[model samples]
Target: MSEVLVAFLTGLTTGGLSCLAVQGGLLASSLAQQIEQDVAMQPRPKGAPKIGLRSGLRPRPQIAGPILLFLGAKLVAYTLLGLLLGLLGSMITLTAPLRAALLILIGIFMVGNALRMFNIHPIFRYFSIAPPTFLRRYIRRTANREATWFSPLFLGALTVLIPCGVTQAMMAVAIGTGDALQGAAILFAFTLGASPVFFLVAYLTTQIGARLEAVFMRLVAAVVLILGLVSVDSGLALVGMPSASGMLRQSGSAGQVVDVPVTPQSGTLILNATNSGYSPTLLHAPAGEQLTLNVVTLDTYSCARAFVIPSLAVEQLLPSTGQVAIIIPAQEPGTVMRFTCSMGMYTGQIVFDL
Candidate 1:
């Protein structure tokens, strides 16, 4: 539950900039169309001039009504799409290796998009998914006709097909969930989280006649680039490498892998799960002894909560603030055990070198 909340908040903060890049223009156009219609419908006093672009902009709080409808439509559409994706995900069970590969691929795509934002090389063209020309034309036509309800709703629905890289990343997670309810929840929460920013932008532009500044746009681009780097870091973690943030820095100047800390334990081996990752990523245990692995989590909402030990076929979802224990069968000497998160993003190892 807490993990879901984290996902929603993640969308909220990141969507302010990331979603704006993808859906800002369409929303702005819809607002403009709505404002024009509102002004046209107003009865002008005798000898009064028509409202021009620079004319007195009256605040129309009613604009929020249609914008809310638009957001609601988008939330429904994305949630339904997520359900279908989740159903498909269940059909094709994703193994750790495959999931890791997908994360890395998506990460690369995000990085490329970030680079393109700064006029860097377009590295991953195939990942770009643009809505067809017909869809764009339809949206424009609806706006021109001043179909207030339909235009915003339809445009919002269409945005599902033309999402930004951050959205694509979340979609990949949705597919990985493999549960209809979970998938729908994730996407619905994400869309809901993004609504505030979109609504605010529309309100300011249409009702307040505020123009988007170039400086603000540059800041958004910088944020997108940072998100891209974070995505890449997550991908690296899934692939069993060091995080790009240097949380798991390489040991030597040659960039050699750091020695995973190994602790010898008997009976129950207790481990703490932190926000960065599992403490003591490496462990040493006595073989041929009945052992229990106890994971203590305190308010953890990151991917690490979904624990997995692929080699042992053990998968467990830890609570946000509690302890979960796994009974480990006696293992043979010299056995190396690997444990990871659901996506293989956070990993730890247990060595039985007796």
Candidate 2:
């Protein structure tokens, strides 16, 4: 699947994952309980709610504290999830059925989450419980439910479960990796990339959450929609994209074939890209064996070239940047291998040395 598509899907999963981590179905219930407690503890106001000073500017600021807490907690959850996925991606092998199941679960979550952009959750509506049972039901110690750091942290965690479309796509990608550690790394990076907005929003939930909530929902939807498309790309790939992969493998730049004389063994190849922004990338290695690519880019200003091999029918994306040694399976011999930019523009190949 395309990296862009995968990024979108990963973003969605991160959203839902965040949601689940933070709330776990307790969002609405907890907020309602908090409302009850607040009302119960305070003396009733004598007159109608005055329009001026008490109401203040926008109500988002009031909720900021809770929002941050909610978002932060969720981010923590996803971070942990990422770590777990990375670790797992490195370990166990997955069966086809398991991969497919994970894909479907992820897809449903992403699509559902994207649809939520249009969804009007009762949680967003103003509903409060009576004060009588407040003490027994409230969860947080915040005096008011209007805004708080915890709210965002909770939402951030629970957001991951929202069933966003892109998350589904990402899940498929993670599953395809065949190794638990790699899958986890893919998810971890994806979630990390997508969490900043929620973190910021959590900090500002008080003065802006009401207005921004809708925007956030829309953004989440957009992310999921993109991810859903990527999921379709990958899911379809498992069935067969031999034709497309073939097309990608068909051509390379017209540079003379010198067969660069670095004799790395049949199972391994170390590529030291001589120029800035370019690395000798490969594709198609046997899926089960350990494979290594040693990359070094000359320029510090421009990040070095990263690599990817799309046709293994596996779930992880090969790195396109950063100087690090990651362990991945060698592509199956004869599998179409095509190298591309970190941005997914096809560059060249290693055509598996079967």
Candidate 3:
């Protein structure tokens, strides 16, 4: 539930604006004829000042029908995409290394996308994904044919081919779920959350001018850059590498050692998983002793429930409220094992002491 909510909020904020920047052209083209017709149908009273482009007067089109149809098709398309991604994920076992690699790759793409938005380098423009030339020509031809009910629907579904950076990030998350229903739910929630912003911006850009759109794109670029960095950090953490946050923590706690907790039962350590994060992020235990690590979760619905120990190739989806025991073999002195949520958003470590 918490995971779904987070996805929803992400869509409402970053996803909406980012998607608009990429796909707004399609929407505007789809409604071009309709907007013209609406403007034509408006009555001009005699002796009234002439309304022109410079006059800042235009008809507000009745666009609810077309917009809803477009959004509905888009929602369905992305949900099916999520289902397919989840099925693919379930078919193949994604090990920690593979998942880490995927995360890093997606992160790089997102960062490149932000750079492209900023026009930092001409090479960064390659980060923009587009349909094949033939397909693009065909879609444009079809969109220009007429303002029919099918135009918006077709364009909306086609958006799947040219997803924005944030949408791609969410798609990566859907694939990580490894469950079709859950993946579908996540995408569905996200798309629904994004609809309002998409609609409002589309309406405003058509009715008003491009100035607002420019400002929104700049904001989207910043958000995309931040998300990209976070994704890279998460991927690094997943592989037990030194990440930005981890480095900061290490620097802050330099020369300060965390004492090994005395276990209630010898050779067993207990850790709690909550909605926020893992408790006792640092732990220590005697080396050369076989150990049982018990993970307890009570009403936890966040990503923390998807527990992972990357070095051990261990991945477990914990129940909302339960205890799961993981057996660890005897380790050499000075051995350090790191654990994190599947997305690497939450993390902890256990150090084996002599």
- Which candidate achieves the best TM-score against the true structure? 3
Clashes of each: 0, 91, 0
Cα lDDT of all candidates, in order?
0.65, 0.43, 0.75
lDDT tens digits, residue span 10-108, model 3: 789867766765665566555655665676788878876655432445566777777777788889999999888777766756566776776677678
Error of 3 at 40 (Å): 12
Model 1: residues >4 Å from true position, as ranges? 22-69, 82-94, 97-102, 119-130, 162-182, 201-212, 246-269, 281-294, 298-301, 308-316, 319-340, 343-354
lDDT of 1 by residue, 43-64 (tens): 8888776566445545353688
How many clashes does the backbone of model 2 have?
91
Show where candidate 2 strays beyond 4 Å.
Answer: 1-61, 79-90, 95-101, 119-193, 200-220, 241-354
* Candidate topping lDDT: 3
Alpha carbon lDDT at 59, candidate 1:
35
**lDDT comparison, 1 vs 2, better candidate:** 1
Per-residue lDDT tens digits for candidate 2, residues 1-354, read: 333344545455455433332232344333433344444555546774432212432322233344445545655665555445445654654543344355445555545545554565744222222122443234344424544344434444655555333343355445445455555555665665555554453333323435565676466557655554444433333333332332343444224342432333655555544323233434334443566644544432211233333444332333443344444454565645443322232234555553
RMSD of 3: 5.3
lDDT of 2: 0.43
Q: Cα RMSD to native, each candidate?
A: 7.0, 10.4, 5.3
Error of 3 at 164 (Å): 6.2
Q: How close is candidate 1 to the true structure, as a TM-score?
A: 0.65
